[model samples]
Target: MSASHYHICSRNIGKPVEIRTRDGRVHRGIIHRVDNRMVYLRPLPQRNYGGYGYGWGWWCGFGWGVALGAIVGLALLPWFFW
Candidate 1:
């Protein structure tokens, strides 16, 4: 499938997604949102918090709800910060 075919598309709004970071790690979560170059995921309970790929992005796995929200919000509006 093409990159745009990821589960984060509009039709799969509430579906689950699997993310493989650049470091060979994996995460599974709800497809919160997807932008041109990044995928925002609210990682599943079992696969939350672990090694992350090196890149400009946000990640949340366990109890850091507030931090997670902040990152996702920023990613959604990258123009403001970029």
Candidate 2:
């Protein structure tokens, strides 16, 4: 990730974001928290449950909804550099 990526995450705290990591996995959720190393994501309520309401929520480290890269905020325009 670039420095601007962290900048975007910092500016749009507490907003919805979609993150695509280097592994090709995509995570969609709200921005629970952001720091120098990682960006925590709180997954949507409906997507959290599997069948009988047995599923995990947001995590800190290597798990669901936790992405390490440039985060795209759903409610904001993509950052552009000229």
Candidate 3:
């Protein structure tokens, strides 16, 4: 994904979204936060066999982590050069 995609998604914070990764994995959840490169998602609660609701909590994928690191490095490029 590109930076613009991240920016656009960030604007939709708290809204439901379906993210399709490059590996063809799909994740459905409510967007929590979006930075220069990574989107945080909070999974929706699911009902178990016991009739109790369980939350999957939050998750950040490996691809997103790499992207975020790259973005942070680029953002600090100017500081390092100067």
Q: Pick the candidate with the highest lDDT.
A: 2
lDDT of 3 by residue, 1-82 (tens): 3766666566777666555555555665566677775767666444355654555333444222223322221120121221
Model 2: which ten-residue window has the lowest total lDDT? Answer: 73-82
lDDT of 1 by residue, 7-72 (tens): 324456445544444345555555566655545556433433558645444555531111121222
Off by over 4 Å in 1: 5-10, 45-82
Model 2 Cα lDDT, one tens digit per residue, 5-57:
77777788766666766666666666667777677766543444355654544
TM-score of each: 0.40, 0.56, 0.54
Ten-residue stretch with the least lDDT total in model 3: 73-82
* Residue 24 lDDT, candidate 3, scale 0-100: 51
TM-score, model 2 to reference:
0.56
lDDT of 2 at 71: 43
After superposition, which runs of candidate 3 have C-alpha atoms over 4 Å from their true positions? 47-82
Compared with the true structure, all predictions reach lDDT values of 0.41, 0.57, 0.51
- In terms of lDDT, the poorest run of 10 residues in model 1 is 64-73
**Predicted structure with the largest TM-score when compared to the true one:** 2
